[model samples]
Target chain A: MAASRERIREVVDRYVGLVASGTAAEIVDLYAEGATVEDPVGSDVLKTRESITAFYSALEGLEQRTRLLAVRIAGGEAAFHFEVQTVADGVTYTLAPFDVMTFDDDGRITSMRAYWGDDDMTIG
Target chain B: MAASRERIREVVDRYVGLVASGTAAEIVDLYAEGATVEDPVGSDVLKTRESITAFYSALEGLEQRTRLLAVRIAGGEAAFHFEVQTVADGVTYTLAPFDVMTFDDDGRITSMRAYWGDDDMTIG
Candidate 1:
């Protein structure tokens, strides 16, 4: 059976929460083994589980919070607008990216492409 | 030269405004000659200008309004969350779709895929 809309919404919520507080390993677990991640869209895609883990690992120890501003799911895929605020060395950086993801039947993410750029980030 | 971030944002704003009040021909002028549109994502793509124009023509005489809730542009591409409210026969239908679009250096849209399912729509 195809992934249900409820299931997809649950996963999107979980993903945002994990990005805020869970370990990188925990976030990586949400994806299928061969999932691909292309955060910031124009960047190189991270294809292997190891690389994907590394990508999220960068935030493992950061002081950050995330909010899912909005999400639209259709045909086993979701496009979400989310905000990530990170504080380091007494400065806060905020970026809201629009991410598109496709999921497998089990609701595991198959691919993710995030749309944001340097110009979108604001520092305070 | 690549499309600038400001240009992309301007285009996004114009596109939303056009959806709300412009004619099908006016909206089609925002695309390149060979642009493609796949509204609601899993549907058949409209590749030619004629087909794309036909798709938007459905809204020509409708009592409708649109709002751009959010948009993120990166790498000459944009993903936007927008709301469309239509009233017909004394009933109002509202649907918000997350649309992803790629543009050329001239800021003309090259392709678009909208993400929204029947479950996301509401009637009042």
Candidate 2:
């Protein structure tokens, strides 16, 4: 169980590192070919590497400090609660995002199902 | 087991039914006395029933239709992915919300942690 938690944290840490560094591609590396990213607009089911780049480009204002709130892992599936801080069009916004990651035995992520909204800014 | 899944569905169904019917009190009944609810503002560790009513009354534009997207139950904790539709201040908004429910053995929900953003209006 501890090993599973460690693996789960590693996956989350790696992905967060990418977003913190503003490198969406590195974050995309954690996803499998058929990963699905969902949000208010719709859902994305990836089939190729190129599509990953397209998906990242479509998202704007992703800067430093993307935080993961919680994680729950069971077998090949893991669910995460996240908050992403970004600035879009010169206005700062905080979006709370949740993602479910499914992985193979080799630790390669098989899918990423995400739920996020751009208008989710928090008041401090 | 099949029984566990059915129990899980019952919990979810009951909760959603309360919200869909705009019965915040009924929704409160689904929780244990000290359930914790989390959101962007902060976390609530409900020690009494009044806090639940206070929490519900604080929110505006919650007329109808609170949807639960997905649910996963393991032991005492269950995580649900949900979307709630409401109209606030004469403007329509669709909020994508998620809740994690913790229940005791008797099927009484002990806690309900909510994550939702008011700006999450779905674009059709």
Considering chain A alone, report the TM-score of candidate 1 relative to the true chain A. Answer: 0.97
- List the global CA lDDT of all models: 0.92, 0.60
**Share of native C-alpha contacts between chains A and B (below 8 angstroms) recovered by candidate 2:** 0.00
Q: For candidate 1, lDDT tens digit of each residue in B44-105? A: 98998999999999989998899998888877899998999999999999999999999999
Give me the TM-scores of chain B across the candidates.
Answer: 0.97, 0.75
| Model 2 DockQ (Cα-based) | 0.04
Q: Kindly state the fnat score of candidate 1.
A: 0.80
- Model 2 lDDT, residue B115, Cα: 46
Weakest 10 consecutive residues of candidate 2 chain B by summed lDDT: B115-124
> What's the C-alpha lDDT at position A110 in model 1?
94
Write model 1 residue lDDT over A12-107, tens digit each, in one string: 999999999999999999999799999888889999999999999999999999999888887789999999999999999999999999999999
Index of the highest-lDDT prediction: 1
Per-residue error for B91 in candidate 1, Å, reads: 3.5
What local lDDT score does residue A58 receive in model 2, on the 0 to 100 scale?
Answer: 60
iRMSD for each candidate structure, in the order shown: 1.0, 13.1
